[model samples]
Target chain A: MESVSFPPLSRVAICGGTHGNEMTGVYMVREMQKQKMDKTGSLSVSIILSNPRAVEACRRYIETDLNRCFTSDLLSSPVTDSTPYELKRAQELNAQVGPKGSEEAVDLLIDIHNTTSNMGLCFIFYSIDWVTLHILKYIQSKMTSVDIRAIQLDLPISEAYSLESVGKHGFAIEVGPQPNGVLRADIYNMVKEAVDHIFSWLQEFNSGSTFEGGEVEVYTLVKSVDYPRDAVTGEITAAIHCQLQDNDFKLLQRGDPIFLSFSGETVKYDDEELYPFFVNECAYYEKKIAFHLGRKIKLTFPSINLTG
Target chain B: MESVSFPPLSRVAICGGTHGNEMTGVYMVREMQKQKMDKTGSLSVSIILSNPRAVEACRRYIETDLNRCFTSDLLSSPVTDSTPYELKRAQELNAQVGPKGSEEAVDLLIDIHNTTSNMGLCFIFYSIDWVTLHILKYIQSKMTSVDIRAIQLDLPISEAYSLESVGKHGFAIEVGPQPNGVLRADIYNMVKEAVDHIFSWLQEFNSGSTFEGGEVEVYTLVKSVDYPRDAVTGEITAAIHCQLQDNDFKLLQRGDPIFLSFSGETVKYDDEELYPFFVNECAYYEKKIAFHLGRKIKLTFPSINLTG
Candidate 1:
């Protein structure tokens, strides 16, 4: 596949609460809005609360997942399926932020989220695009505490439906171990720090800062594993094993307990070792996802030609 | 207020998951059914999964909460409101477990639940009935690790809508710091031990085991406190303060920090000393309950109630 690059930074959108209970983004946007962070930055920073009603209700969404409603097929339809609350919100957001590559669209978008899983502080990119990789490397260099385990989207980058998908340089900053609807001061400060750093980098680049982009280690998605369920009933009969409950981003070897039934039976991972993230996320309960399996790999980024 | 008593050695029902994601009871009931624990003891033990579909779905409930659907007015209506999934389930459950005071009705009910809050092990009684208090004392006496705090329902016993309200001696066991849909083996074991002890006590009592009930310390519900929110928008702006998070069943002094906002604003308890439980419960988000406040007090039970 050919590599893609980001253009010079102009407008940036910091969107939150695409899934309302993920309060990290919601509060980050709220704080930025309260403090008028947009006025201070040389770059035009638009702080967007993607689903205000869901944020107010402290739910994931009113009708359907806002994150999953932004795919190309869903967006391009003329007689749009605008009945669900999120689909309408998606249309409104796309019109406001992008249709990226369109005139007056944001150059970059940073969507924020929190999870109940022990995912640590990580950036999720849709592809191994050169611009996205360079930005990831820069952020990783600045924030040493950020885990090196970046997740590339399982679906093709073009089919990405997340809020960030509408922007030229869009990605999500997912932080957690924080429960849904409950914000933590530590998580708040960490997210704020990362957001501030991203904008600072953008400001420097806008003022003509360029660098020789290098290599960074990232994890790519393999597949997701669901909790143990009854063959006939299809109801989950076991939970993520005690040893692996919050062990997101950890390597799981063959024969390791992945689930534990109430009857004291243990189910082990029967395959080769793989890194698991988003372990036992509360929001993913609807999807019956216990965890996502991924593999770590080093990807080299060619020095980007920065536009002045 | 008049005190009520329970007849000795009648049918007993142990109900689980009237609100589904509370998995302690679900697992307990599943284990009992699998092992035929119901048949081992002389007592007529009935194991019921209150909302099987929700339990199967691993959700709180498909529609409305089944626990809140058992009011007398709801049960007595000639033309039933069976639109919501839970309402219909409640009617079916009432038909199966009780018409409460009828001959075939369960003599006692134990509804089990698990919470995300740090509410260790607790028993909630709908009324200040003698048999309930005696059972509470017996269990507290037997299990030294158990906290003595108890919550008396604010609603009149006649109007109680929980699954337990359908039994002559009905109460709830709520254990926590456990997340929804994720069963902790420790919590599962703890609930099973309690249920086993309760059954053993019942069997012993029916076989001429007699004892005088005594005074025990109990905590009664004062009221619930909601997290601070944006007045106009009604969106929660603060989280349970770090000091107060996981501080369930702990005494809150007159000036204790309760919540912390994104702007580093700390909101303190501006009232007399009180005990707080169910702090930062995930399920109470819909009700906007940050925590429930209560007061500890001593209550005595009459000894003449041994029906054998």
Candidate 2:
């Protein structure tokens, strides 16, 4: 593969509280704002609390999920009188820092999130953007305090839906085992450290340091599995099995216990062996996802460095 | 103490979904309703889903918390157009099984609950009632699978503010470490086993068996501690310390770390030593409680038998 070069990266945004009940991001943004962190080394940083209303109410969102309102079609749609609060906010955000896929977009964006699942620290992105991958590698190398991994959503950039997609290059940092609306000191510390590493990496990159490319393992989502439900009532009839509850990112084999029915029966996974993640997430219960299955693959990229 | 005797206990009520998002109770009540569990030997059991609307929405409550609406003052308050949904529901419930402090109340009531704290299986009640204490002793003896303990709120029966206080002799079963809006099979199983044991104990007592109650250990409420908050914004400034996160029911001494501030400062406990429970509960964050401190005590009671 040929070596790649990019223009100097300077402008960046750090977003939190996109899903307002996720306290890690909410607090992270608040702390950054309190410190008035606008410029760090060679990069100009913008700290944002994405959904103030939801944060005040301690809910995921007031109308629709703001995280899902960032696709090109939604972003470009005309605003109306009855438009949801999140959609209106998304438009304002796009106008301020996004106008996504345009020349004036921020060089990079980092949206921090928390989950109820025990998925240590994960970087989730759309497409195979080299800058985002290099940042993930740098953070993974520097942060030895927690397990670090990357998840590729396999969507076209125009179709990507999330706050991070508003930037020229971006990804979401999802750290967890923390419940929604509650903060854990250990989890909060991990997020802080990861964000610090990202800034350090960006500083070096802007100063013209090359990032060596290597075989990086990434998980691409295969499918989502929903909890077993009663046909008549549409109510869940089973829960994630004890063996799989906190075992996010573990390789799941066929015939492994995945769910335990209310009637005391174990429902086994019957598909090919794959890794499972977001296991038993509290917020996903409304989205109908009990857990997601992913296929892991090794990706090799060329060395890259800042150009002018 | 004299061996207390009462009319053969026959009518009972098992209440669940009072707080709505507590899945253990919601599912227990749903399963019972599905099985049409009305009679268990000589005892007539009424299994009720206490807050149906909240259960449907998967929220703690639709308006004000239903669990706190069962006090005498609130129950007797006349309903108006602006009455909160939960308050009205409380009155309906009091009419069905309570008319509290009246002769028509059920003989025994068990209100099932779940918390995000790692306090294991606990029995919480108001006042010192021999029957409730004996029931706790029976449950502690039978359910060896999980840690079993009891907490006394030290409030007069009429001043008690929960659904269980509506019964002639009542208490609540609180199980946890489960997040709100999420269910665990292990937690569900423990709740099932406890409920089964309660019914078995009731059957044996009604069959003229005398319960041998000697010494039972209980935790009595001392006070509650709130999270460190910002003076102006009222937002929490620190999180429960890593050492104390899930260490509910552990003894804490003065100078022990209880909170870790956002800027990496440790806030030490400066009060008397006590056993802490409800540590880092998700729901109580709004209630301004980081955890509740209690003093452990030993209560000695005489064995009692049912009277004709």
Best by TM-score: 2
Q: State the lDDT of candidate 1 residue by residue for A111-210, as single tens digits.
A: 9988777787878878666766777777788878666447888666458988888887788888887777666666787887787778777777666666
lDDT of 2 by residue, B1-308 (tens): 77878787789999999988899999988888887778879989989999999988888999999999888999999999999999999999999998888899999989999988898999999988888888888888787768999999998877899999999999999998888888888899999998898888888999999877688999999999999999998989999999999998899999999999998899999999999999999999999999999999999988889885
The predictions' CA RMSDs to the true structure, in order, are 4.2, 1.2
Q: What is the TM-score of each candidate against the true structure?
A: 0.85, 0.98
Using DockQ as the measure, which candidate wins?
2
lDDT of 2 by residue, A1-308 (tens): 78799998899999999998899999999998888888888989989999999999888999999999999999999999999999999999998788899999999989999988999999999989899888877887888767999999998988999989999999999988887788888999999998888888889888989888876899999999999999999999998999999999899999999999988899999999999999989999999999999999988888899885
Give the worst 10-residue stretch by lDDT in candidate 2 chain A.
Answer: A136-145
- For each candidate, what's the DockQ? 0.36, 0.79
| Residue B190 lDDT in candidate 2 | 93
Ten-residue region with minimum lDDT total, candidate 2 chain B: B1-10
